[model samples]
Target chain A: MSVVRITTLSKSISNLFKSLVSPLALNSFFVLLITLNISAQDVDIAKGKSLYNANCASCHKLNKKLIGPALKGVSAKYDKEWLYAWIKNSAAMIKAGDEQAIAIYEEYNKVAMNAFPQLSNEDIDNILAYTDYVPEPVATSTTVSGAQSSTGEPSLANDIILGLLIVVLLVLVTMLYLVTKTLTSIAEKNGIKIDQPKSEPFSIWKAFIKNQFLIFSSVVLLLLSSAYFAYGYMMQIGVDQGYMPVQPIHYSHKIHSGANQIECQYCHSSARVSKHSGIPSLNVCMNCHENIAEYNGEEDLEKGYTKEFYTNEIKKLYKAVGWNEETQSYTGDTEPVKWVRIHNLPDFVYFNHAQHVSVAGVDCNKCHGPVEEMEILYQYSSLTMGWCIDCHRDSNVKVKDNEYYTKIHEELSKKYGVEELTIAQMGGLECGKCHY
Target chain B: MKKITFFSVMILMSFLTLSCFDQSKPNYQFFPNMYESVGYSTYQESDAFANGIEAQLPVDGTISRGWVPYDYPDTNEGYELAKKELLSPLEVNDENLSKGKELYNIYCAVCHGSKGDGQGILMKREKFLGIPSYADRDITEGSTYHVLMYGRNLMGSHASQVNAEERWQISQYVISLREKLIK
Candidate 1:
């Protein structure tokens, strides 16, 4: 009974010291919580977890190295008193030439850590405990998901394809057998028996062996079919319609475009007027990303990308843009993020994004495919000459209310006697329209 | 002979299967010269170019063909002066308003919000604060253009992103949004 009271007394003192800023809430809640936690009074791991998440989560992760180092077993690395002082004011210690403090400051590229003067020793301890806390592993969930989902393939599609192939093979075999049987029956009915001659050589092509004309024609047919297939394979050599490259950061257009409904022109603003749909510079990223430093999607891992994966990617952006989220100021340590360009038109093709987008009013999705739903962007269109010519031939010119085309439209309509004039009709098919 | 034929058929089948899988690879171009031209990249530095820079800047005090130079300087005085004087060159119509709305949603709404109440995604998430409501301010099309031309406070200049025509269109859209917010 005495031991129990002493432990409870100690817990209240620790919690009181931890929550000094919010004393009234702590005192009132501690009384209620004491009854529930009367027996095992130790480091409140849950309280620590919430506190760590609220304050330190933006720059720190428990197991992974984030903007700051991982906090897992961080309590073991330094003395309790030192940690308390450092956490409360790291810059002061670093300025004062404290060896350990200066080392950490330098280790993280001289980017100063934010001071948490309000967090008490006990509160810091609670955070440390939460970092050390590990839950039991669940292997079943990962295995179950892995078995169901495979990249570039859905199980249903695979089954359907296999079923179709089997059906095709069965039909071909049945036809061949039927044809052979019918021919043999016809020959037997007419008493034209195909007998083995004593003088004839034993050849594999017995039927065509004696007939030079039949052999020559069959060989010619085989050669023509092989050439057809070979020509088809050669034609598709450089047409990378579905080329998906891994970028420096895993930016999901699906979440930004589809889920958030950010307009395509918002980031790629130059697409409206420029020849190229420009890759958004880092400054464009910082416009929203300065505030949106963390990712907290209310769902399971998407396409095997865990919560940690996306959160870290955002951190990489911060590092690249030299943003210090703590003071919300740039740290002046900027580096250019090398992004791999996906859509590349050949030198011969003079494609103007503005001509198609601003002038013609083509949707970005018409050429880029359904980018809104893409987890990773890829070249959506074949972008062949035939593809461009086809679009120009069929697509109607938007000349109704658009001022840019109205004058040209009136003259063309009178000349051609057609109200709906395609882009092809408006000199879109001219060699000089795209080339030179 | 039969075994050799079977092996050859198996080899052909494997080649067919492999071809089906390489979907990400592009088709071959007949002429390499057409595909890859001998030209300098836009941003790449060249030894022969001045300052090793490829893109050249226009002479000072000169504007491009379509773009007119903004007269007012970037200052508080400029903002105040433009507010009283500046009026949109373009008239208020469905054409301008829709384009204005579309442009607003692109550049401004990410911070200022679609409704212009300053409760954009950045505000709702508490990433940034203190963005004033359009209705709260006494603004004119000129002030809006001045702000876009040379940014105020936390917002940076958007002159590079928008043209003079687009700037006018956006000012029209913002004025309409302000009227809606006033109600």
Candidate 2:
């Protein structure tokens, strides 16, 4: 009876251990799978978010119905296939007399949803998947906690370890030096002749003066330094790399480009066709600022001296155009916003924004280094002839489907036997192309 | 060796000073009386004078300054390219459209309608009839450019009030608003 009881107790204990280990292991495995899935989903969601913000956010909202219907339960409301078809070309669907599409079209007072044939099925799926994700209450709190702890602990620990390692390395090097010095001193004491002089160490300057080899090297160094200085001075004669000047208005590209995501072309529309990506006029501001009297963002509000970012900037514009913003009407005492032009090319050099932006299809970011990311707009690219030539030499023109380049692409392909044609190959680097 | 080095240093200093003095004078100083130096009267009697003396004469003392003329090769090509590359000139948000509509109603609705239908109060009152809806006009980028440059029949030149690029933007916005109306 005693043996049986002991055996039963042992069995129960083992079972308890098994139960504990199994769930813990299972929980970790589940967590690993979940983390991987969540990250992958997050990447797609991020892409969808950007796409939504760019194309759809202007008309549609997630929770609230704006110009279009609320998109909160859009995934559940329509099947994936139907949603894809509707989003791609709503007008087509309506024309085909699709009941659901026609009903939505009528419901929205027949405000036509802009066709997005460019959007792919995968993109729509990702957008739908993003919408379907529902955050758990506990998960939200844990994420916040995790973010705080991770941000603080990892960086602090990394800094501490780096500091400790540096100190240890320094101590080790010092000890090694000391050991060598001690060994050398001991050898000297034992009447072993050392190759190095026992005389007091001379400073580099003194040595340079006394030693003929050092003197020759110093002369060479001096000559090289002068040559380098002369070359650098000539190269940077008009190159204003860090040229930040006070503008007529404190127009922050950080605010407009970075925060607001105002496309560069919105103001610099001339970039497409004309040589200059021209600065926008007061009327352009009036188009929007006529309604957006105030900026909603906090950063703009705090640093923005004149009530609103646009209002203050518009005030500067008003001063240029002689229009007053205070009374909600034009006072007609305007001055042109004499914005100090940042990028100035040499008289001989010719640069065209249209050629780069329109013909070459080079992203503004390629030359401007993510102007949208900058707070205070600064000249990002060197805008040098060499820089332009280098890019032209490297960058292949987007010739496919471009009606303008179709004929050129064919002729070039036949000549070179290689389909790829760089801008340089297409006369981008010619002296006349840049200079004339 | 010391004597030779000292003499060389002196020569170098004198050369530097001489070069500095030479550079101090302006480029035009060589020809103080450029008209007299060129012998303007003698050139006038020459057979080349028949074409125009103004063309023969060198540009007075002022440097050419190498001003590159702003070349807009093809206006139509430019507008099409701009449309493809540039963001919309007007921010077409709800607030912007609302303000645009309001402005259109106040300033433009007398001729162009609240919905830009070309049937404003002015048209109803018969003040100006046949104000074409923007959509009805088979407007290319060039046609818009032309209209903006030189005003049409009744509409006076808005070029004075609006700058060159703003006209393009207004044209773009007008086209967009027209699109909205037709739809």
Candidate 3:
């Protein structure tokens, strides 16, 4: 029996050793092959990348369809000679009735590719090499995401500890209850009474009714509270301070303004010259969205704003804008994105955005709050008459370099006997300034 | 016992009142007629227009106030012709250059770096790629204006955001940036 066991054990050990060594040897061989392959094409790819970025990147992307077709593995699809001729002058080939050229021209809505007579055959070969080059994903990235989860482990631990505490407390309470029951039963068996306080029936309401001072005080307190509540209810009637309506599109101001650091006036261009800060038309969106088709930004997975979720939102934008991504052309079918307006002043009030934004040079954040930080935009202020007046009273008027305001500012400063003048002092409080 | 019940009821009432403030909906208006405009406000949905929207596009042939007609077409040949012939009406002055710089910082600097080195924030972030430096491209004032009027390649037309004067101002600034880069 001992001999048989020893033979089987040796066989199992050899099997385990072979299993380990075979995979290790194979992995090293593949790694060596990949590294050699990369080194061989590295120089060509480096040059090709710069050339491709300069000449081709404006219209073409590596994998995704842009204004032109995807350039990844493009060499496999067409002959090198044909690619060379087409790259130099695609229009000439289409005119010459080349079948492949014509097919491409027709496929891409007849948009002629820009002729690059500068690029030689070697340059073209390098570009193709660059297109074919795919970098292996680093193992460290998974470890980094793993590290992020480990950082989050503290909160998970805290939750578990709290749950354990609750369970412990529950157990202790039940045990205490059981102990008390047994003790009471033993007391009853031993003919010993725990408590026997004999008293007449009592009613809290009756006692409270008998107390005149308490009743009077309670009535006054009730009246005061009711009046306070009523005042609060009336004051907030038209406020809408935190109105955050769901927009047709989930356009995160946080992503655009905060993370991207885009200036407020980039989209709200009208704020510089007009009374209203007009909503940017769809073309403004197309300016960036045409190129940035995917969402590769940071995500709040807990909030369900995942990578896929943001990408879906981008798709919704494309759908509303009627852009055919495959053809890279407008379909002439668009539905309006009805963005819910958050800050709406009363009709009587005349709030000029240019006055605040351009003339006064007030920061957009001064009124709009930290709009960049807000994931879902809501009214930061009450937008009430009192709120406007309060700002006008406190904030100094910005007059420097403003030709329109210079004269008024000088006169107002002289009249007020101060170097600086508040907007309220400069006739901002005048009824006719806002209301006719 | 009665007092506890009474106090709980009051607490519940307060909670209900507080919870009634739904953020998704507008608050109760004192007078909606006073708050809302009688006249058609900008971007308002209405029955007056066939499209049922207040913000309508200008008629196909009609020109709004202060609009200068651009003669150049959007074709590549038009781009070449415009590059050679289009001249800036605005003189190269400090005021114009400064205004141009300001406008460029707002509109162009996001993609076309402030120094026109093609290292703008967007380019650095890799959102946009292969933006040529101002010095790299042999662009004149006219070509710049034409490109601004009708955007070439990946760029969209900025005409809607800026007026003709602003475009010329931006072009002047861009030329200045190119000169600085060349130096």
Which one wins on TM-score? Answer: 3
TM-score for chain B of each model, two decimals: 0.80, 0.42, 0.95
Cα misplacement distance, residue A95 of candidate 2 (Å): 38
**Docking band of candidate 1:** acceptable
Candidate 2 vs 3: which has more TM-score: 3
Candidate 2 lDDT, A112-223, residue by residue in tens: 7767787898788667765665556667778866866775687789999999999999999999999999999999999998786434345655766888987888899999
Candidate 3: Cα lDDT at A424 = 89
Native-contact fraction for each model? 0.36, 0.00, 0.73
DockQ of each: 0.24, 0.03, 0.68
Candidate 3 whole-model C-alpha lDDT, 0 to 1: 0.90
- Winner by DockQ: 3
For residues A1-436, what per-residue lDDT tens digits would candidate 3 score against the true structure? Answer: 9999999999999999999899999999999999898667554888999899878888899988998899999999999899999999998999999999999988877678878888988888899988988888878899968976986788789999999999999999999999999999999999998885433235666788899999999999999989998998999998989899998889899998888878889999999999989889999999999999989889885577877888899899899899998778899999888888989888888889998887888899988999999999999988888988999999997777768888888888888899989988988899999998
Query: Residue A404, candidate 1: how far off, in angstroms?
Result: 5.2
lDDT of each: 0.79, 0.62, 0.90
Residue B65 in model 3: shift from native, Å? 1.7
Cα deviation of A52 in candidate 1 (Å)?
A: 21
